[model samples]
Target: MSKDQTRRRILEAAGPVFAEKGYDAATVREICSRAGVNLAAVNYYFGSKEQLYVETLQYGRDPEGQHDQPLTWPADAAPEDKLRLFIEGLVRQMLGERAPWHRQLMLREILQPTGACRQLVERHFRARMDQLLGILDEILPPEVPLSRRQQIAFSIVGQALYYRVASEIVKFLVDEDQRQAHFGVDQLAAHILDFSLAALGLHPGLAVPRPEVTHEPLEP
Candidate 1:
């Protein structure tokens, strides 16, 4: 294989290995064996196993290095539209539209951070978090504190992640028919958007109306 092809192959192979075993447990020999490349190729191309792990993460997150696509929107787009897009992108990523290993590796990092974890956050997640916070700033009232805004941002992301983190539980809780109907990317995104907007007092019409309760005295 050509140099670029060889490197790409290693990265592709490394992503799943590192994702499954994490940085410490994963080995270069296994990665090279999986890639069908010589063991020396990893050291030559990525310099070290740690560096290879970092690059594998980058490849898994965005193989093309297309950083601008997800957060990009028309300048004149409404905050609500931006928020919808953000939630959709997040839900899609969590649902493995990007790739299953991408989410799996990220979840592993969050749960058990390593030396490369900071780099992952700084390179990939910080920009996304900033974008989400900016959207929340537009939607939430000015009086809302930054701390509270941060909480709201985490809440929004948590709702999307719940479907992925508890996928089996979700399957057990939601029948296949209901899952097929309402748990799709678009449906879940729309639900989260409407739910968030209503909570922020921005889209009261989208909120589900609560059933009226009657209080009647019972005769003895």
Candidate 2:
């Protein structure tokens, strides 16, 4: 395999192993064996198992880069409109049908953070939070305390997470067809938008809905 292909193979293999066994129990040998590469390949591509784990977190964040950046809104878009788009995108990123390891590895890190957590936070999570915080600024009054703004930001984010993190429980509670139609990206996005608006004391009934914008590819 080419170097890039070899590196990708390693990451793809590592994601599931680390997610399943976690950082401490997962071994370099198992990852290499799964990737179909030599033992040295891990060191060659990622330096160490710990570094490999961190890069795998990046891959899980968006190997496809579907959710790498915050949603783009037109300059003249309403704050409510902007917030809706952001929530939809966030929900889709979290719950959209994609690789299992994408969420599995992330949840592992969250529940049992390792050396990789800090880098993942610095590289991915913080930037996404800043984007949400920017959206909150437009709708929120200036007098809102910074601490309160952060709480609000996390509240919005937490809603998106609930669908993914607790997805099994959700599936158990709803019929399969009900789960399919209601939990779809577009529907969930609208629900979160209306729910969040109501929580913020904005009238969801008064907000105008616009066509959801198609996502542009992540920046290279």
Candidate 3:
């Protein structure tokens, strides 16, 4: 196999292994075996097992080769639209071309988090929290604690993605129709968008409603 193919094979193999075994418990030998590649190839492509593991769990951009289209975040797009894109992009990236393993691998990392897990939290994920802090500040009153935004961010991401990660429990809790409907990413995104709109204290989707001007009646 070509060098690029070998590297990708290793990534795909190592993700599940890390997911299943946790980071420290996982071994390079198992990943190499899963990829059906030579030991030297892993070293050549990634330098070390630790490095390979980190790359596997990072907020990876999907490997689209030349055909990967960039998200067109129009200047006028609502913040909620951008948020949905971020959430959906994350979901798609994990699923890659293999949707079935997406939950298995993701749930493993979430439930049994490893030290390398912080690499993601420190990088894109933490930064995402910061952005939400800024967004929520715009909607909530100035008197609200600075910590509230960060907490809200955690709840939003945790609520939406964890539902997908822990789908078996969700399936058990909900009726068949709601479960089937939310199984698709667009439908999932819609549910999340509605929650986010409420969190932001606004109407949702293609239109953001005008605020009603309510005046209190004068004392009679």
Pairs with steric clashes in candidate 1: none
Model 3 score (lDDT):
0.65
Query: What's each prediction's TM-score?
Result: 0.79, 0.75, 0.61
Estimate, for each residue in 120-181, the C-alpha lDDT of model 1 and write its tens digit: 65666677889999988777779999999989999899998898778999999999999897
lDDT tens digits, residue span 1-220, model 3: 7768888898888877776677778888888999999877778888887778667755232344342243446656677666777667655544334644434544555666656656554554455566556556656678888677677777777766676566678778888996666556666666666777776667644354535636658669
Misplaced by over 4 Å in model 3 are 1-12, 19-21, 24-27, 38-52, 55-72, 83-110, 175-178, 204-220
User: Which TM-score value belongs to model 3?
Assistant: 0.61
Q: What's the best-to-worst order under TM-score?
A: 1, 2, 3
- What is the C-alpha lDDT profile of model 2 across 124-193, one tens digit per residue? 6677778888888899999999999999998898888898778889989999998887778888888888
Cα-based lDDT for every prediction = 0.83, 0.81, 0.65
Candidate number with the higher lDDT (1 or 2): 1
Model 2 misplaced stretches (Cα beyond 4 Å): 1-8, 19-21, 24-27, 43-47, 58-68, 99-104, 204-220
Find the candidate with the highest TM-score and give its number: 1
What is the full ranking by lDDT, best candidate first?
1, 2, 3
